[model samples]
Target: MAIGWLSILKAVPWTDVVSNAPKVADGAKKLWETVARKKAPTGTSASATSDTSSPAGQEARIAELAGELDRLQQEMLASSQLLKTLAEQNAQLVRRVYWQSRLLLVVGLIAVAGLTLVLLR
Candidate 1:
């Protein structure tokens, strides 16, 4: 089972992923910032304000819709923050994997060199 997983990991193009990780992280950060900086929609819509003669019930419904919109905006900001965090974590993991693969290659080469010298002697 572990060997199968290792093979799959080996097949991935880590260099490409590592190269793109920063861009992904940056994009996520920008998305989060853009969402966070926007002001929430005011509870009073232009239509709601323009028609002062609207019935009480209609005004109440408009207020409720406005509240729902605010809630959705908050949820969007939260989702964007989560996305930014995940992107950062993914980038960190890719960097670690890339370095680990390089280290493994160097170690394998040294081992092969040692074995060849021992055999020659």
Candidate 2:
């Protein structure tokens, strides 16, 4: 019953989850196969104990840290993409301003040159 609850909870259907069901199932199957194929963790190992301050608790903590690390990496990547877009937009704005100012300066210089020439003639 707990296993069934876990499957349903993990399938939260968040975002593109609806489209990912098949892939998620395949990944879960692969995880089970790999774990089952491997030699079972020896009971003699320190991590076998579930006591307070046990190695198993430390391993679980590390796994949790790793999951958070993965989520943070994804968030950083998204933020980088957004920052890149904002930088491009800012650069385009600067370019537009530079060209507009250059154009005005050129027109002003040409008007001054033309007036000076007319006055000399």
> How do all models score by TM-score?
0.58, 0.48
Candidate-wise lDDT, in order: 0.74, 0.60
Q: Which residue pairs come into collision in candidate 2?
A: none
Model 2, 1-121: lDDT tens digits are: 9997774454343444445446545655555554455444345455434442777777876786687677666556655655565565556556655665677689999999999999999
Per-residue CA lDDT of model 1 for 37-109, tens digit only, reads: 7667656677757664568857887787787788667767767766776776677767777877788889999
Candidate 1 lands at a TM-score of 0.58
The list of candidate 1 runs beyond 4 A from truth reads: 6-54
TM-score: which candidate is best? 1
| Residue runs of model 2 more than 4 Å from their true location after superposition | 1-52, 114-121
Structure candidate 1, residue pairs in collision = none
